[model samples]
Target: MVSPHVQDELRIFFTSLALGACMRETLAEWRPVVDEAIADLVPREIDTEYLESFFGEPTYAYDPDGLQRALSDPLWDLLDRGGKRWRAVLFLVFVEGFGEDPMAYLPYACIPEILHNGTIIVDDVEDGATKRRGEPALHHIYGRDVALNAGNALYFLPLKILTEDPGNLPAEQRLAAYEMLMDELNRTHLGQGMDICWHNEREVRITPAEYLEMCACKTGCLGRIVARLAAIITDQPERVERAAATYAELTAVAFQIGDDILDVENSLGRAGEFGKEFGNDVREGKKTLLVIHAIEESPPETATRLQEILEAETNTDDELAEALSIIEDAGSIEYAREHALELAADARAAVDELALDAETTDRLYTFTEFVVDRDV
Candidate 1:
């Protein structure tokens, strides 16, 4: 049984998760307006079948039940597994900071959630991850081919959502949003490429600077996109936008480092509770900041053993234990914690520079605190 305090935390996280569903419902309300606009713009009959084919072929033809079960059901189930909705909240918070009605940007808020879940579906396949949000990964249930198609399908939905202007955003703003979204997608994929390359190259030593850059591209880009879009919507000055992006980037770095720390610590079964296998990063040969620090600081024998553990085709429980011990003995865990704190502090300072209301600023600061202090 979970403690009352832990239950309370889960409740809060679920509440945030519900916000994404709420945004989806709100966007559904605008479908009629969007359909009418599309009807006016296009004269031909739109081929509905192509929608499913956009990502790839269906599992079976002339069997609606089979197709739905193979793709749509699994995709929706994965999304339903629930998340902290941090990205959506970040976008909404910035929208509020600009004095805009957040509800008016509900469709925009859904973009990040869609993109995030899509990435998770594909990432689980890439990492051979078994669980997500306390449920089996989409690929595990639906097969990798179907999961990949569904996940990639989700990637295009955001483009459709953004370009369709369900909220009746100005044409210029819509174009700008599309441009920003494209840039973010590019950065994310590039960063993922770097990560995949490093992991595959087991013998390659990664520097702290390289790891930070990867985090900026892979993790920080989402926050940067949200801030930039919010600024665009609010017609804020360039300087304010830059500050917002900087704050979000810093927050992302801190959050990712904290995540790496948790992967090593597996604190209180937090990783399992959060729907991930603990220490799988080690199994995957991830060159995390702690690993880098430990290798650079530990004794030659310890560092060599750590590398061998990472490079091994498979690691037993005892081997993983030894790797964790090396990290702790080298003080890399503490180093990561302190580094996350410093990043969070810099994020707060960046928020201070933004021309936002006091309440908005406080919310940003609170989120920064949550990034560094959250246990799960």
Candidate 2:
């Protein structure tokens, strides 16, 4: 017989494992269809490596020598540091739910993955990020120009993948899909712009509402695009659009708050650190929701100290510690955590209105939980 504590622990672990396995299976069910669709274009001789090499193009006339060096460079290796194939997975999820052939939207699925990579490349540059997936950043290893162009090269891949002669798709469907892709592209750019603006204007003061608006522009919009594009492919554009928008808003807010929390809780080496000599956000003076709320709620002396530290040209470790103390004592961390939970709950409710098939809906539900519960 097991002790009560051990039994409870085991039960929780198994439950989590089961949920993960279900999501894995749901993603797996679509792989064959995706593979077949990709195979339709890329010969069996081609693999992910060759695709990465092709993505890193040069500015000058092709010198096979220089081209080979650039292509073979390790800087582009982030392409292989795979995740859940989430964006592609979402694309196919929507396709399957609409009772459409999974193969039909495999090409469209490539759009999100490509765009996602493009953003990461540019983001690393903007953030001056040193590491990606435990490896040197592309900008760090390849230099800014190559990194920029390589990212730019990826921008066109989605078009190449998506517009690949729609073969059997009706002209109307094909046009509709392309339009959806364009809209997502525009929305994502707007979000990226907001993120960049926030990064550059480090001293800007913002309220929680303003911070949410920035997220809607910077992070939430892309997420909205992710689900809505899936709906477009599935041809359930109207019903899924609002659901996608709502999920994107909540998830984005939670994600940013979690990021700020991690900046405080985790060590700098973990990529949670935004690269300041100390608390990056504090040092750079980026206005995050937590910082704003903490200032608002702090006692007069604590607020003055935080303001002084934020305005300092440099903050020492002691200053960083003191600032964090103020933030925590002001209850900003707990506030952010509760807000994330509330938004996540709202996002879950929004999904209930969709007429998704049982398995897909369950996978989506699991995905929402995973998003909020994520540790990294």
Candidate 3:
């Protein structure tokens, strides 16, 4: 993971290209704000006084150091690992797009970023992944119990900010935000469940539409939360909220498809350039859009062979390499890339339905471009 000092550079620097030079530079500038928000909410160092302030002075004594070790360490370890923190930035972008001064809502911006990292810690364990951000998964370093508890803590820790109205938002707005978070969280788990079930299949049982739907749930839920939270603060009409949420959701789907492309294209290097192992998706037999499309478009024999590698009890490095070749030969990489572009267009169309200002619309367009075009 790059250090916070380097991250002061650009958040999505390694991602695919989009936006003009001016906006691109501005996007980098947006990174540190999200970073600052995350730091503010979940500091690297924790003490009893901090706990008392957050959880109230305990009726019993507070084990500050132990809680810090168990909770703060693992969460920070994962955070110190590289994440674009785009979700938090996305929250701010939408707030600005809806014509709100995003700084006023900065505290709320931390929610999705923290929750996204929480998912990563838990996801690594669920995926049985060995590496994250070029190192061992948190579970490996912290022990399963500690990692699990730490990961779970991230999920609820941000909720306290919401429930306590730390932002001093109205009671009605707080309730709306709370309900939205709960709804999206459920969708995220269901999407993860579908992902697990599909990957575990012995055959290609998932369609492109089905895969897109799963992505809408798994990856898009947090994206939706980012937009929806902004909508709440902006007090946008339902139509505007729906349009903004759709843009976020579809952009997330496009981003996931792009990442799946990298699973085959860039999987050969970078130890999961996108925070996973080399060919990690193949190793997991992840039925990514690449594999799904290859199976459908290739010759029957070729299709059968690809499935054989995926369904194998365990794949060798050679076999995974072969799988990449098979998908490439089927031209599934370009096919998937084209599909991602379509999703980005769909996302833009969602924004077009809104009457937002040109700058806001352009920024949304720029974000969609980044999602489909990113290299990792």
Per-candidate TM-score against the hidden true structure: 0.79, 0.77, 0.88
For model 1, residues 109-223, the per-residue Cα lDDT tens digits are 6677667778888888998888888778888888899898878866876667666565677888778778878888899998898898998897748899899989998998888
lDDT of 3 by residue, 287-348 (tens): 98988999999899989999999889888777887788889888998999888888888899
lDDT of 1: 0.74
**Residue 7's lDDT in candidate 3:** 45
Go through the candidates in order and give each one's C-alpha lDDT.
0.74, 0.65, 0.81
**TM-score winner:** 3
Model 3 residue runs over 4 Å out of place are: 1-19, 22-30, 267-279, 316-318
Which residue pairs show backbone clashes in model 3? 16-373, 16-374, 16-375, 272-276
Models sorted by TM-score, best on top: 3, 1, 2
Candidate with more favorable, higher lDDT: 2 or 3? 3
What order do candidates take by lDDT, descending?
Answer: 3, 1, 2
State the lDDT at 134 in candidate 1.
77
